[model samples]
Target: MNISDQLSITAKGNPSKTAYIFQGEKTSYMELEGAVTKFASSLKELGYEKGDHIALVSGNSPYYVIGLYGALRLGLTVIPINPIYTVEEMRYILKNGDVKGVITMDLFMDKFVALASDFPEIHHYIVGDTGADVSHAQKLLNDKMKSFTGLMRTAELSLERPTIDDEDVAIILYTSGTTGKPKGAMLTHKNVYSNAKDVADYLKYSPEDKVIATLPMFHVFCFTVALNAPLMNGGTVLILPRFSPEDVFKVAKDEKATVFAGVPTMYNYLLQGGEAHKTDFESIRLCISGGASMPVALLKQFEQAFQVIVSEGYGLSEASPVTCFNPLDRPRKAGSIGQNIWNVENKVVDELGDEVPVGEVGELVVRGPNVMKGYYKLPEETAVSLRDGWLYTGDMAKVDEEGYFYIVDRKKDMILVGGYNVYPREVEEVLYQHPNVTEVAVVGAPDPNLGEAVQAFVVVNDTITEDQLLDYCREHLAKYKLPTVIEFLDELPKNTTGKILRKNLRDRVTQ
Candidate 1:
């Protein structure tokens, strides 16, 4: 079945139920289904045939959802782009993905207009006006330009979904190019739908659940967990424009949100918000954590402060973004990504692709229906990632005797200090234990004497000297693992998903 069929089924059972709540505005299941159908019909009228590529670049909004589901409903491959990308950055994705059209917000109108002339393949432009005025230069482009709202209203509603095979590619999610240029991971309809359904089932999602959709939908984690899983389960999604600890807490308490999902950085920020800014998370039944590993200290602190339990999971963009999550029915392990979810299998293996013994650190490999079809137009990269049947995640991890997986760090992020391997996450975990440290990211900086030295970038909640923080790390970490330098900043850099950008820290320090 098509992914859009989830809405139709939910609407049939709960037509009047709230499907999405954005900025206090409510859209019922039936209404959302109608909008998606109308928008899909409109795209069809523009001659966007099945298997064509259409890009959707925008922040969290109702229009983004409509565009996403509409494209999927008609079997068009949706390319999700971060709206903040520069003209050059977006141009690369559009050209690489072979995008035939784009649906972007008015905020990005200028960028598109500037780059439109370079790509004649993009024939249609649907602009979502988020209270932003459009540019007058729309007449310059050869493509037809129309407001997204206008199309949704004028197009005839076609409840009939186009024939979409389960194996048809649905979304092409580009990776955050920390290592090199980004490559799009082609997620098929079955790949996404299977993961969403399994995620909803694993999390014990019910129709009564109200999920906080704070993470950007462009990323696979939020696309499947916060958006697709909730929709598939007939739950309500409370949409937030962006992640703000204060705003998230207020909305959770005000809207009575039952489930909240976010990354470690968000959790640290929420913890740093302290008692004064703390919202009664009494309304939240369960909190989900991903994008990055949650520091064990921060996880415990937040649980105590907010009076809620947070289950952390692990996955990359290539695996339909979810391979393992802490099961709701079992005892949630503190730092473990938990066992593999239903129908998914995970193993920690060495360089030879053979599984290591329990408690041995190695690469995490996953195999399941949820795995992506392959990387778009990059067969060599796809072959490297997908071997035999398992997708090598390139994440250093270990599984306990109970089969709970613990992410050690990204293999590329491991530091070689004086020929001794040091995982940045181990040092960051020590730094997080400090009373004053709110957030920390560790990286390797060039050191003539020792090959490489450990340097830490930290965000502190209290007035603490760098020396003192380093001294605290010294006490907890081994001599080799201790950070040699500590730099205090107001905040650490993060991606749209709130994952701490360690590569950025290394770049700053090396410069």
Candidate 2:
């Protein structure tokens, strides 16, 4: 079943229950359903039918929830974009995904104005007011613009819903392009709903649970775990715009939030807070750590300080984002990603697709309903990723005899900085655009707080300051993908075929 149907079922069962609490406002299940129905009807009136694509570009808020479910209700594919992305990055996704409309805050109206000419295919620009004057935004957007609040208020609460197949695409998530440009991973309705149900079952979510939604809603981890899973199971969500140690503690105590999910950096920050011990985290029953490997020391320390158990799990954007979560019934493993959940099957295979010995390292492959259909509009890439019935995850991992899996390294040379994926090639491509750079290589460096940091080694013909190069990157790259360290090298290490040896550069950083 589609997520929209699951939400309707929950609302019917618990009409008076609180669906989500944003800031100080609480929206009941009945109210959320009404708003979603109204928004869906409004979109239909504007000629948005099934199989159309719309982009949701905003931070975590009630607006995000309404837009997401509304689009899904009409069988429209939702492309969730990071609100902080550079204009160029946003343009690439909108142009590549063939987006027909955009749902974004008024603060980002200027960026859309700059990109309007580049992509004339985008017909509708729905602007939500986050303290910005809607009248001024409408003036800039012209007749094509529509106020988000206006649609909700004027539209009727009735829609002729489309018959959405289970295999139809629901979300087209763009992975941080390891090759060069980001490729969209198409997640079907079944892929998303199955993963959410499995994750909710594995985590033991119940109606009485109140989950903290501090992680970015755009990311798959938070989208499935902190938002979809709870709402599907008739639980309440406490929304936060951004992550702040002070804000998290206050919300957890005041709202009595039971489940908190975050990356390792967040846990480290909370542990470093001087008043962590005194903070009333007693209401929290479970803590989830994902997006990156949790350092054992930080995990142990945080549990001691807060008197709560932090269960670590593993997932990627392609697998509807979750494959394994530490089982709640068993003794939790410290470093493992736990075992494969529910109907999913995960195994380590060698170069020839043969299963390796239990303790040997190999590429991790997964097969299940949760795996994505394929990359959008890239048949060759999809064929390589999905061979036979299994999705070949490019992660080097080993499984113990007890079936617990440990990720050893990334075969794709990916860097996980503060739980966000940063590809070396994506950063290298941006640096190559500079005229002064003759050659360049980017690698992951050891970081104390972020787990890993981006470092660049350059061989340049002309003089260029690090600040100057960094200023250029800020225009094209996100803040998390910026290189923290820049080293001047005469020439990069290379093999006989003239391929830059990235392993050597990574070793140099560690040394």
Candidate 3:
């Protein structure tokens, strides 16, 4: 079934119940259903055809949710982008995705305005919590459907758009490629809806369950587990624009949220200065960690502090993001990421694509409904990742005798800061733009709170203070992508072949 059907089902269950709680705005499920119907009619009136790409770049708000499902009802590909990206990155994505329209807030207008020079195809631009001309404003706010309330009201919702099955692409997610560019993963509607069902089933969430939607909606974890899972289950999702540890705890306590989903850094920060006693988590039934690995020590600390168990899960962007998770009813191993989720058949395979013993570390492979169709436009990379309908995750891991999986290391040099994926090469590229440094190499260092941090080693050509380079990095990199640790060395490690060895740098610092 199409995901928007959940809206109709939920509106029938408890139409007046609060569906979202932002900082100042609150909308009931019935009101949310109304907003979605109105917006879908507005989109149709504005000449938005089925299968057109609609980009959403906004802070955490109810607007993101309404915009997303409204497009899905119309069978449009929703491309969610990080508002923290540099202009160059945004430009590349806009052009590559062939976006027909965009919904954005006013704070970051400069980048899109610059992009407007080259992107004339984006004819429909709707500003949310921002300003636009009268025509654009009326086009968005105008509700042409006088009596329609749900997906059923919109007859123009294109049920005949070439028979949209579960395999039809619904969301296009961009991941930092190993080749120094971004690759878009084409996630089918079946991939996401099934994954959300698996999540809701694993977590045992119900209609009364209130999930704190703190993760950015752009990320797959937020898309499937945090947002869509709750929506599909007719649960309440409280939206927060960004992540703040103090505020997250307060929201959990205020809203009496039953499910608290977060990354490692948020968990660590909650543990560092606050007393997360049983009272603070009185209503919390489940605590989930994803987007990165949760250290064994931190997991234990959180459980001990709050007197609640944390189930650490694992996934990738290409797999609609929810592949495996520890069940609440079963025994949970500390270091294991848990058993395969839903219809997924998981195994650890060696370099030759052969299965390895339970004790040895190898690449993790999964065969499931959650696996994405392929990369949007890159067929060669997609072929390399998919074999016999199994997705080969480049994460070095192992399964124990009892079928519990543990991640030993990452096959790629990616850093996880707060919950954001900061590719080392991406940060290094920004450092190269600096005129003061002669050479720069960014590597992931073991961090206590964040799973890992982006650390930069530089060889200076002129007199430049560390603060100056940091300021420059702040200007280019996103808040979480900025290097937290900086050091100066005479030169970088190089092998006889003159290729810089990142392993040498990581070892020299840690050891």
Candidate 4:
């Protein structure tokens, strides 16, 4: 079923129940459905035909969900852009996707208008909020956009959902590339629906569950796993437009959120939020971690402190993102991404594409309902990623005899130091074991003796010296897996996706 139908189902069952809570404003499922149908009509009024590319550039907002479901309801392609992206980055996306129109916020209007000078393909620019008079706004959503309260006024929408098959592309989510020109993953409706179902099922979400929306709506992690999954299960979502560790606890406690989804850094921040011990966080029953591997030490400490275990999962942009996750309602696997989900088949293979024996490190490839249709307009890249219906995820991992999978690191991010391959993730894992090491990233530095020396950029929790960290890692991990050179950094460079841009970190250090 289409996502709009899911929202409709929830509206029928729980019309008065809060579907989304953001900035003290709540929108019921029925209200959210009415808003979406109105916006879909607005798109129709603007001559947005089905399959037309609708580009959205905004942070996580109640309107973000409205635009997303509205566009999909009309059978249009929704391309979500990172709100932090510069006009140059957005230009490539606008022109590349041949976007017909945009549904952006007041804050992004100026930057978008600047790109319009170069991108002639873009036509309509619909501004969302009534707070500002944005340029080229077809109309403003007014009070509904302002407070997310009131009646859903009908817009006399005539736009019919375009006849789309399971294989038809729904969203073009751009990711990867060092040049900052993102590669768009063309995900089909079936892909998103399947992944959402798998994750919702794995997490055992119910109508009674209230989820915290920490991750950005643009990111696939939130779109499929958090947003879509909760909607599919008819659960209430407490949306956070921007993350504030202090506010997370307050919102969770106030909204009585049951399921909380977060990245490793967010989890760390929440731990350091101070009221963690005092604040009763028992409302949060299931916590899921994605975007990066959860540090074992952090995960263990989190469980001890919060009385909730974090189920670490792994995915990238190509698999419509959710491939493997730690299964709920089963025996937990510490430091592992648990088993492959219900509709996905995961296996580790060597250079020859043959399955490696259990416990041997190999590239994790998956065949699943969640796999994307292809990379938008990039046949060669699509061919490389999808071979015989399996997406070759660049992540390298290993499986145990009990079918538990452990992700070693990103294949390209693997550092070969001292002629002995040292997976940075392995070293980082050890560094995380140190109580004082809050965040750490391992990268290969130019070394004359060893060709490439392992260097660690660490963000310490306490006053721990480099020697102390190395000694701690040495105890937990092998010598070769330990960092040879350690430097304390305020923070490591990361992309919008939260993946460490090791190349950028290296550039900063070398320059």
A best-first ranking of the candidates according to their lDDT comes to: 1, 2, 4, 3
**Candidate 1, poorest ten consecutive residues by summed lDDT:** 134-143
- On lDDT, the leading prediction is 1
Instruction: Report lDDT per candidate.
Output: 0.89, 0.87, 0.77, 0.80
The candidate with the higher TM-score, 1 or 3, is 1
* lDDT per residue (tens digit) for residues 1-511 in model 2: 9889898889999899999999899999999999999999999988899999999998899889999999999999999998877899999999999999999888888788878888778889988888875665467668789889999989998988899999999999998654579989999999999999989888989999999988888889999999999988999999998888899989988998899999766775687673644466888999998876665655676788888889998898999999877788878887788899998999999999999999997999999999999999999999999998999999888899889998765776889999997877568767866878756778999999999999999887799999999999999999999999889998887532133577788889999
Q: Assess the local accuracy of residue 4 in candidate 1 as a C-alpha lDDT between 0 and 100.
A: 93
Worst lDDT 10-window in candidate 3:
143-152
Model 3, span 1-511: residue lDDT tens: 6677677688878988777788746788888777776677667767787788988887777668888887777778999888877899899999999898887765555567666668767775566654433443334333321211233345342332234567778899988543468889998888887888888887887888989888788877777877888878778897878777777778888888898888765775577656754476778888888876666666787888887889999998898888889878887888689988778778999989999987987899988888989988889999999998889988878899988898765677667777877666566656765756555678888788988888999877678888899999998878888888789988777432123567778876677
Please give, for residues 174-266, the per-residue lDDT of candidate 4 as tens digits.
985664567899988888888887788878888899888878889888887779999888888889887877777888888888988888888
Full ranking by TM-score: 1, 4, 2, 3
Q: Give the runs in model 4 whose Cα sits over 4 Å from its true position.
A: 130-154, 157-159, 276-278, 496-498
Error of 2 at 12 (Å): 0.7
C-alpha root-mean-square deviation, each candidate: 1.5, 10.6, 10.8, 3.2
* Model 4: residue 215 alpha-carbon error in angstroms: 0.9
Cα lDDT for residue 420, candidate 3: 76
The estimated TM-scores of all candidates read 0.97, 0.82, 0.77, 0.93
